[model samples]
Target: MLIDIFHDTVCPWCRIGKKHLFDALAKWQEQEVHIRWHPFLLDDTVPAEGYEFRNFMQNRKGIKAEELQHLFDYTQREGEAAGVKLDFEKIRLAVNTKLAHQLIALAPTNIKNDVVEAIYRAYFEEGLNIGDINVIVAIGTAYQMNATELKLQLNDRDVVDAVVAESAFARLNGINSVPFFIMNNQVKVNGSHSVEVFLEALNSTALLDIPAKI
Candidate 1:
């Protein structure tokens, strides 16, 4: 089975949703599964330097700072339940994620998911500016990717266009949200679903291939 995940690095729910999907995979050991990550830029117009995280959320949601805290509190609890940490208070910027997505695209298949998680951890947990080229270069190098070559590729015009185009392709396909999943190119699930929902999708697809599993 193949799972294509459309997500932006800065989305807190996307991180939680990723954990849920992996949790389901842990139980569904009946078939080999491959995952492909795709970019879904939440706000593509964000400047390269990024926007102030608190103000951006407040304006985008039309909610007061305290009200936003309430929402974040709920999300934090949900993230904890999902075994993922989401420190909203620590975040300072809503970064332009095109470069981050490019790094994920450049990563080898085996280490791609790890690279994705590292980006999430850096932005959400450590409050690092992932939009910065130096930060991304460091991340790539930490994973044993060639630092100088990775830096060059990250700055290449073609790579930027490729990541941007991939994001556009998602919007063209009517996928305007993060954490969207397509299982076996048949099951379409949106939002941050529970582990059971993911398992249901996995089992349904697995049954099609191995009918006698029950």
Candidate 2:
């Protein structure tokens, strides 16, 4: 089974939703699944330096800081229930995700998930400025990639265009939210779903067989 996940790193729901999906995968360890991480930038118009989370949410959602914080707190609780550690207070940056998406595109198919998780943790948990070249370079280095070469590739016009094109395609397909999961090229599941939902989907596709674990 192939699962194409369209998500943004800084998106709280995306982060939480991914954990749920992973938990489902882990629960069904006998299943052989190939997961692909795709680009889906929530704030594609935001500058490279990004914006402060509080300010961006207030302006975009027309809500106050308290309300946003409450939402974050609720999300954090859900993440924790799924054994995901969400560092809400640590996540301070919200930059343009064009470059991050491009990097994901350039990565080898085998290591794409590793690279995606690293970027997500860096921005949401470690509070790193993921839009900065230096930070991206370090992230690439941590993944044993050629940082200098990646820095050079970051300027490629094709890379930027590809990310934008993917986002537009997703929108055209009725994807108005992040963490959208497309399974087996036919199942279009939007938003973050629970582990049970994913497991049921897997079973329906005959991609998973559940047996007693003792």
Which candidate has the top score in TM-score? Answer: 1
lDDT of 2 at 211: 30
lDDT of 1 by residue, 1-214 (tens): 7888999999988999999999999998877778999999888889989999989999999999999999999999999999998998889888899989999999999999999999999987899999999999899898999998998899899999999899999999999788999887777889889999999988887666633211
Instruction: Give the alpha-carbon lDDT of every model.
Output: 0.90, 0.79
RMSD of 2: 4.5
**Candidate 2, position 90, lDDT:** 85
Q: What is the TM-score of each predicted model, taking all chains together?
A: 0.96, 0.91
Reference-based TM-score, model 1: 0.96
Which candidate achieves the best lDDT against the true structure? 1
lDDT of 2 by residue, 1-214 (tens): 7778999877877877888888888887655678877788787788877788779878888999899889888988887787767787886767888877778888887888888888878877788888887887787778788987898888889888988998888899888888888777666667778989877776665543333122
> Which residue pairs clash within candidate 1?
none
Task: Please give me the total number of clashing residue pairs in predicted model 2.
Answer: 1
Give the least accurate 10-residue stretch of model 1, judged by summed lDDT: 205-214
